[model samples]
Target: MPDTLEPVRIASKIMKINHAGEFGAINIYRAQIMVARLFSPQLVATLEDFLSHEQKHLEIFGRILQSRGIARCKSFWLCGIGGFCLGLITALMGRAGIMTCTAAVETVVTHHLLAQLASLEAENDSEAYQAVQSILSEVLEHQQHGIEQSKDSLLFKPVSAVVSCATSAVIWLGFQL
Candidate 1:
């Protein structure tokens, strides 16, 4: 690809992956909420709030994709299904598991977003930079919330390591497609 086209391609791929990530996040929260209702009623509200945020993020990325005339990532369905399964399984493992999964996923996601922002800035891609900046704070918030929630758990470290690795793998695969 030409140098000028490289940034556009990168930005488009990032947006597509971001949109798909939000879709997966929404599904994950949805699955978590469903299971939480039965085992952790107190967490229902928090999960719902996070789900709403993910929904908004999804819309923001969707608009970016539309404006750029780029198609959504091919991994969208994979993300949704895989995320739901991960959520359901983690919820079955209880509160710590759920929060650990969030912390892990958000940790990887935040890192990716920061990397994207740096790349966008270097390329002077203001449009994509602004779009990414708008959501960066909330992504950090999600990561912090997950950490706080999982603080008292004995399994946090191990669960987080495993989940984070899986999240990283999925993100790498998404970008390759």
Candidate 2:
């Protein structure tokens, strides 16, 4: 019989990819917040809080990547640039639009993290299982906060899917590049 280690390897790969993606998310939010401060100080402060949480998430995954000896994709630089560019564009779109973008990104990230957690559960990978559990909890907290904060806004349920799908597809392709 083939070793079950194969699934574990793939799981590790997913985890690393996820970690890199989280890093990109962090940078995107940071750029958005930076650009936001120019016109909307209060909103930028709010975004910064969630951005800090994402930074922590990135740290957790970075540790996991290091422990598993998983190297980040070389194309992650391109992904970062793409995320930064998206942030710049969103910022240019104005405060409401930026928050809408934030909500969209968080929603998709929450779903993706949940899926990764499910995969880890299926693999029964104890270490990765624990990591995913921790990370998902953190991500869910941010997701809930974003949803609540944006509930009455124009971005809550209206534009999240379209924006998220478009941005996520672009970012995913950026990683592949």
Candidate 3:
């Protein structure tokens, strides 16, 4: 790639990864909401609120990706299915399990966004850097929300580590994908 285009490529790649992640988040929340009826109304309300926030994040990232002309993942449907399966697995593990999973994923995403923000800052591309900063702020909010929601759960620690590791692995493979 040409030198000038390299940064744009990096930005676009980050955006693509973010877009996919946000989409997956939305799907996972959707699955949770679908299964919420089996649980309490209070739990359902919380999950619904989380889902709405994720939906907004998805919409924002989708617009950013589209405006940048980045093509969405060819396997997005498959990814959604995979996310649904993950949600189902968490659900089977119970409410605490599902909440832990959310916390874990959000923690990883927050760290990933931090790294992206650093890279964008280092690149000295103000526009892209600012965009990343904005994304990072939203990601931080999401992480905090997840933590607040899952604070009382015993599985939070283990779930956070496992999810952080899994998300990192997924992102590593994403570059090749």
Candidate 4:
């Protein structure tokens, strides 16, 4: 689908949003790991693994932003703070809550990234597009893992809906900022 937003503008916004998103994801997992240590010890390792992936993704976008002299997203640290709070709350709810949060946020992220890729391609912003492409596989994997893990969680439906909405809102806000 053709984007209503201009291609160049969308491409730059995509990079900023994705960078901020990775920052959010990193904090989310960090908080999840902290709580999982007590409430769901078995999940700590997986959380750590996810954390590492987010950190790498952050660097990928960060480097692009720096090289291109694009300013960081206006919402960058806000995302981190919000992410940690969301993570703490969800983690307190237990494993299913953790999975639900991941499922919801990643679902929004995947949709955004796919759309971003299309816009970036249209703009011929190869550097930004390639950077986005490189991180998409792992984002998909995270989404898949969350979907699989939360399939049986009682909290899946409601929690996912709320978190997904919140995630979408944040992404939208990033663009506005």
Candidate 5:
């Protein structure tokens, strides 16, 4: 049997990836908040709110990992460092750039979460299903917020495309590891 076909194993893998992703998201918001304060103080509060949400998500996934005796994804640090760097670079570009990054990341993430939810349902894993479902609305809200904030920027399309590609690559790598 394939490793991915086993429900518990797949669910654990998904949780580990989600945990790492949430941690990465926290660092991204942290870096954004730090840099954005200088150029866009008004955005700091919004970023903080998002960061808080990510923290809750991280804790949720962490508890699941603990209960299942599953370790976090090996890519945890990679995601953190990469997310921070991405956040810093985008934040340097100012409010539009940061918003673009947020929109891009959340767009990719929302889709991934939906896919995970479907997989969990198919596996009949009620715990994972509930967890994923619980966060879906919030994730969609984040994406919508980013879209609304960045829609007027001329750089939105190109920046979002690049960041979305990068986000997709990171997610793919996380699953592989």
Candidate 6:
């Protein structure tokens, strides 16, 4: 590939990955909401709201990918499966687990989105830049909510570390495959 073409390729791939990640996010919230309805009814509304945002995000990326004639990342289904399982397991732990998972995943996601935005800017791809930029505020809000909800510093810190690391690993693998 020509050196100039490399950025486009990377940007395209990242967009696809971001789309797939949104799928994962949607599933996470879905699973959480499922459990929350029974155990944490107060949280159901919150989880549903986040899920709606993720749905919008997924649509944004999907539309962009379609316009560019790009397929979704191969990891899309894998992410959905992993997200559901992760959400189920965490929701079982109640608020702490749910918030920890959200905080950790969104932390990694926020960092990657910024990096991806920089790459898009370098490429001067306004469509991609705007797409990534649009979802950032909600993602940040979700992160902040998670951090606030998890009152137990002792549990939050350690569990969040583990979840964040795993989220990072998954992202790396997504870029690779």
Off by over 4 Å in 3: 1-8, 149-152
Over 4 Å off in model 1, which ranges?
A: 1-8
lDDT winner: 4
Ranking by TM-score: 4, 5, 6, 1, 3, 2
Q: Against the unseen true structure, what C-alpha lDDT does each candidate score?
A: 0.88, 0.68, 0.68, 0.90, 0.89, 0.88
lDDT of 1 by residue, 1-177 (tens): 111224557888888999999999999999999999999989899899999999999999999899889999999999999899989988988999999888889999888888888777877878888888998888889899999999689979888888888788788888789
Q: For candidate 6, report its TM-score.
A: 0.94
Query: Model 5, range 143-166, lDDT digits (tens) per residue?
Result: 999999998999899999989998
Q: Is candidate 1 or candidate 4 better by lDDT?
A: 4
lDDT of 3 at 46: 71
lDDT computed for candidate 5: 0.89
lDDT for model 1, please. 0.88
lDDT of 4 at 26: 94
Give the residue spans of candidate 5 off by over 4 A. Answer: 1-8
Cα deviation at 36, candidate 6, in Å, is 0.7
Q: Give the alpha carbon lDDT tens digit for every residue of 76-130 in model 4.
A: 9989999999999999999999998998999888888888877778788899889
Of the candidates shown, which would achieve the greatest TM-score relative to the real structure?
A: 4
Model with the higher TM-score, candidate 1 or 2: 1
- Scored against the true structure, residue 10 in model 3 reaches a CA lDDT of 72
Which ten contiguous residues of candidate 4 have the minimum total lDDT? Answer: 1-10
